[model samples]
Target: MQAFRHFKRVVTDWFLCGMFLATFLAWLFPRFGSSGGSMHAEYVINIGVFLVFFLHGINLSSEQIRHGLKNWRLHLMVQGFTFVVFPLLWLLGKSVLGTQIPALLMLGFLYLCALPSTISSSVALTGSAGGNVPAAILNASLSSVLGIFITPWLVSLVVGSGSDGIDLGATLLDLCALLLMPLVLGQLLRPWLGRFFARHKRYTNVMDKLVILLLVYAAFCNSMVSGMWQQQGSAVLLMALVGSGLLLALILWMTTRTARALKFSPADEIAAVFCASKKSLAAGAPMAALIFGAHPGLGLILLPIMIYHPLQLIVCSIMAEHYANRPAPQAADPALVSAR
Candidate 1:
């Protein structure tokens, strides 16, 4: 039993360990999952993406949005960092990092930076840290709701339609078709089924993981089939791996410092830092497929996101546990409502 528990913990902490396994499996049977391959799992991939977003919508609540709105200062800070500060950080450093990083990979990282805060993980981490769970939920959910439009536009400006071959209009339509439409539909159903889903949240989470794994598996296979894997070396990948950690660290430091400067209480600080710093792999997977396409270098683009996701989980888990154990600070101003 102890051994089983340890294994589970290891898997949870280093969840991306599974991505490596998925990649290896993709390599071994690359043809099976590739879009052009014999089996044609691309349809399944599209379905998975749709289901992931739909479930995401169902998971959100109207009350949560209201709660997040009540805490505008925190949400604004988080969203500003997510959209504005993050982009500038990536853009200003682009030339320097460009020397060390491949252009495509850097663009991938930029896309990662542009993404909104993750929904489920951000809320879970904040709750675990004894932080403001309601505010976390609101901020994270708002980030996703905003990202459906904002992320694509950001990508368009960063990559340029000519450069990345982004057909902005069509991409928006595709995103709406696959993401927004389903999300709205799910929310409509949420009122009836929200309680049931809340009771079975674990299952939704499992589905989320499975969908991401499939995205990773399919993406890796696409890379292998297209031979873009040859463009990247172990050393380059090693650098990307290291760079992702540093990037996360930088955002975390910025968030913590900003929270302190703003005089947020510990609970609000936790909510701010976590929600502002996280990048959503759930959204990244589908968006990458939609934006970058499976051809050229989709899997390579996914590298930073895959690396960052598990790293954030591991690091934030420790931070959350630390905050959870610390004594509560005085109740933050009710007017702040977890925003401060």
Candidate 2:
């Protein structure tokens, strides 16, 4: 009974559980949140996305940004892994397996590769693992901001004019209006609002989760209404899951090995590995909405990140625990130290 209770508690504690529930509800009642549904979910999600970014700006401290910028080498390593290496890996994977995997899943994997490192989870895991927390904060924050410009451009470049009628100009304008401008406005007003938000962070956190759930519900609803799931078999989802795992494993191996080769200290290595390895669902979902814009395959495009999210959390949590439990290196002997 105790073990069962613990299991239930753990499951509910994960935000992914809420996402699953939202997806399930969306499947059951597709019309409720479809593009032209009675609920008008698209408008709601747009507002929610704007609010999420605005609040994020208010929460971001200039002090932290300045502090985080101190480690250029660490920052370069992490960002290189995120933007350069991951996308290359996707291209290589697609070239090799393009015919075997579904097109939608391949696009999803490419989208996943282009996303930024997850801010919350990367920082949390880095701190848990006794990493350079400021570096994690800086890299994660920069990755997300850079992703606003890079993700769309990268996708459009590779997919030729951004598949599914995605106009780079219009999409960039919309992002500026809904996302970038709000964030800048919030930052401009941060002197007055920052303290309030700092005190009511739980409210902001709730809003973030609410926005994500709404987006997921609406995306899946649209897909279901269009019979996307009916057209694609369960094998696609399994392949996405398997692909997510492989992508994560490869990135993890690369980041850790590269960090070690660079001779990073233990703390910096921990930060580099964690920051370079995560993809942000929070950023990915909203960006997808803006990038895809009611495309029926939106749900399919989200599959890789959705699977990657929970997988990363589980794997990184284990890695964090391992780092936390490891013993500190022994000090050099006094004689050796003196001779040196």
Candidate 3:
């Protein structure tokens, strides 16, 4: 047991480090000067996304859905913060950045904002923080479902048909294939497969991370092959990193405050803030390819999500640790305490 626990910790630490290194390398090498490999990477990424969402469905419990509905206010708040507030802020940021950033880059940022909250990380972070893990799972899952339509519509409104080639119809189809279909299928099979999934939770998470990492590599490779890095210099990239990091920080702080003001317990507040503030690179990358087809500009545009992903993980990991270590407050209600 001790050895198993130690190995688990090592793997977790390595996973975190690997994610950071991957982002740095993607930024550093931006292009591999390799041909014939882009198509393979794209194919692998599409398959990986499909598997990731399917696994996401397997882990979701009926209980979580019931709890989510019972706490509809919390669900609404988290979703609103994700789909509504974040995109508005991105638009405001775009105006401020103006032509200093390319139209494609701005659209990329908007697209990232329009994406749903992450599932694995949100639940993992909330669990680590001793927060409402069920709520995190529910909100994140529902956000993805909502994103099927919300994201494309938001992209249409914010991005339109610039030279970057925002193809709304294709992107919608991609979302349905990569995200919605798997989720629906998983739900349909849950009665039969739930037990199997529950028994292999560890392996499912492994599959999830592996799929996401492959997707990341493929996205960066695609950008590289298209000469994405050459077009957008280092200065714009640096600005995007700074802008996205600051934007994430601002939203995290704002949601944390709002959750508290609304009198959500600390656990719910942690889950809300974490879920609301982060974007899913796993979901965003494929959508980017679909929306910005054949536009090498996508490489520059996806920079924000690439930068934001690791930053949010690191920051939220620390916050989660703090919450986990803090002493539990007196229960506001005995029923709630027992339920948790």
Candidate 4:
């Protein structure tokens, strides 16, 4: 039993193991996850996704909201890094490397850059890293909300056929109805329900992981069924793997430097760095399905997101462990220790 516990700790410590397991399961059982298969998995997954955020709302305290909102500077830096800086870096890479990078990969890179920071993973990573949990929650939620308006507009600029390829208006409606509405409803009822969640936060986390797993499996299965890998040749796929890792390292370094440069508290710095550096697969995958559903290279676009998701998880897990084990400071944020 003790040996089993240590093995479990190691697997859970490397959280990316869950992501890889989900992908392998999807590949092994593609028919069940495929959209065209007998099962109508998306409908069930959507409901699960809704409940994930609804519970998120129930747990979000009024104090968290108030405190998070007060840190406008942190919010701006995070949003800017997610939307503006990431995209520009990709653009520079493409321009400098010009035509050497596959056009399909470039499109994928642009789409990945345009996405907001993730909601579930960013906060989870921050919490694990012993960061300011409330600030991470607020920034991530705000980024998702803002992406509803910003992502489509940015995609339109880059892709030139966003309107014909994707119904921007419909995309907005999906985000608001699916992600935002349930969240708002939960927040409204939190006064009565928050205590239940206070004691049951672990369940809330389980729900988050389940939703992510479903989405990742479904997206990869659909892409594989559509013969996504065959179209992109192994060389380009390899480049994407190497490039995604490099990009993440660059951003993680910058986030830390920016946090220090700006004189943020160690806690605030952790929150900002983790939240800013993550791209939202939850938002991006669905948005891609809607935007590029008809496009021939849909699977290619999803490739970077799939690769980056696990890469970020592994990298962040290392960082989270390092932060969690850091020596305690006299004035450290209480929430940081709460993670340990």
Q: Name the best candidate (by lDDT).
A: 2
Better of 3 and 4 by TM-score: 3
Q: Which ten residues in a row have the lowest lDDT in candidate 1?
A: 1-10
Candidate order by decreasing lDDT? 2, 1, 4, 3
lDDT of 1 by residue, 89-143 (tens): 8887786677877877887788888888898889889988888888898888888
**3 or 4, greater by lDDT:** 4
What's the count of clashing pairs in each model shown? 0, 0, 0, 0
Candidate 3 pairs with clashing backbones: none
lDDT of 2 at 200: 99
Q: Candidate 3: lDDT over CA atoms?
A: 0.76
Better of 2 and 3 by TM-score: 2
Query: lDDT tens digits, residues 1-340, model 3?
Result: 5444534554477555665665566666545412245346556666877887787777778787677667777898999999999888987887777668777677768878898888888988888888888888889888878988788888888657445545667777788988888988888788899899989989987877766565555556557667666676778877878888888889988998899899998888888888998898767766666665545565566778877876787778777777788887665898887899
lDDT of 2 by residue, 128-240 (tens): 99999888888998998898889988888776773454699888888888888888988899999999999999989999988998999999999999999999988998899
Better of 1 and 3 by TM-score: 1
TM-score, candidate number 2: 0.94
Model 1 accuracy (lDDT, Cα): 0.83
Give each model a TM-score. 0.90, 0.94, 0.83, 0.81
Model 2: lDDT of residue 41: 88
Worst 10 residues of 3 by lDDT: 30-39
